[model samples]
Target: METTEADGSLREAAGKVQQAAGDLLGDAGVQVSGKARELRAKAQQLYADLASVARESTLERPLTALAIAAGAGFILGLLRAASRQNRD
Candidate 1:
């Protein structure tokens, strides 16, 4: 998670640099790509934060966490089965 945060920060900074350079050069594609990269970094950071929170919550309330996990697994299985049916 620490490594993920570091990588996300680096990517976000790089994206800002790329975005600025693209804007200065009037390259729309580069600007869009840079924006996408920045968003990806932000999403990664958000995911890590959520995971950390979830981890703490699980530690504090193991039973509730287990129930939630089971529910999520069930939902995912349903979705997968539906997806496979559609494919077939």
Candidate 2:
């Protein structure tokens, strides 16, 4: 997790530099790629952090986590059904 955090931050910072350079050179492709890289790094960091938090929370309160998961699943099912009806 520590390594992931450090790597993600570094990748994101590198992407910023790349994006700025691309802007100076007027290269749209480079800018777009750099932005994508930055977003990927940000997502990875978010996932890692969220996974840690969820693990700890589940360990501390298993029943609460289970209930939340069930509720989320139910809501998703309802949303999917509504979307299908709209399509029909």
Candidate 3:
């Protein structure tokens, strides 16, 4: 009886080792972390590019700023209308 119990424990331990190894091989967390790091690098590069472009392009007029503000407001209003339509 004791020998059988010991063998069962060994089998359980072996199963645990295999499970751990399998988990290590196909880990979603590791994949997601790698993807997140890649995305962060891309975003940083894109932000730097945007900053350089901003430094180069001059929208140096009061009318240009007003037009930009009006366009943004119109886009936002359109988004709100779309959402309202979706709910209905």
- Model 3: lowest-lDDT 10 consecutive positions: 1-10
Alpha carbon lDDT at 3, candidate 1: 88
TM-score of model 3 vs. true structure: 0.38
What candidate 3 gets wrong by more than 4 Å, as runs, is: 1-24, 59-88
Clashes of each: 0, 0, 0
Q: What's each prediction's TM-score?
A: 0.76, 0.67, 0.38
* lDDT tens digits, residue span 3-88, model 1: 88889899999899889989999999999989999999999899888888998999999999999999999999999999999999
Model 3 per-residue lDDT at 27: 73
Return the candidate ranking by TM-score, descending: 1, 2, 3
Per-residue lDDT of candidate 3, residues 39-79 (tens digit): 55455556666665654553556577578789999999999
Candidate 1 lDDT at 44 equals 89
Error of 3 at 35 (Å): 0.3
Clashing residue pairs, backbone N/CA/C < 3 A, model 1: none
**Under the 3 Å rule for N, CA and C atoms, how many clashes does model 2 have?**
0
What is the Å distance of residue 41 in model 3 from its true position?
0.9
Which of 2 and 3 is the better model by TM-score?
2
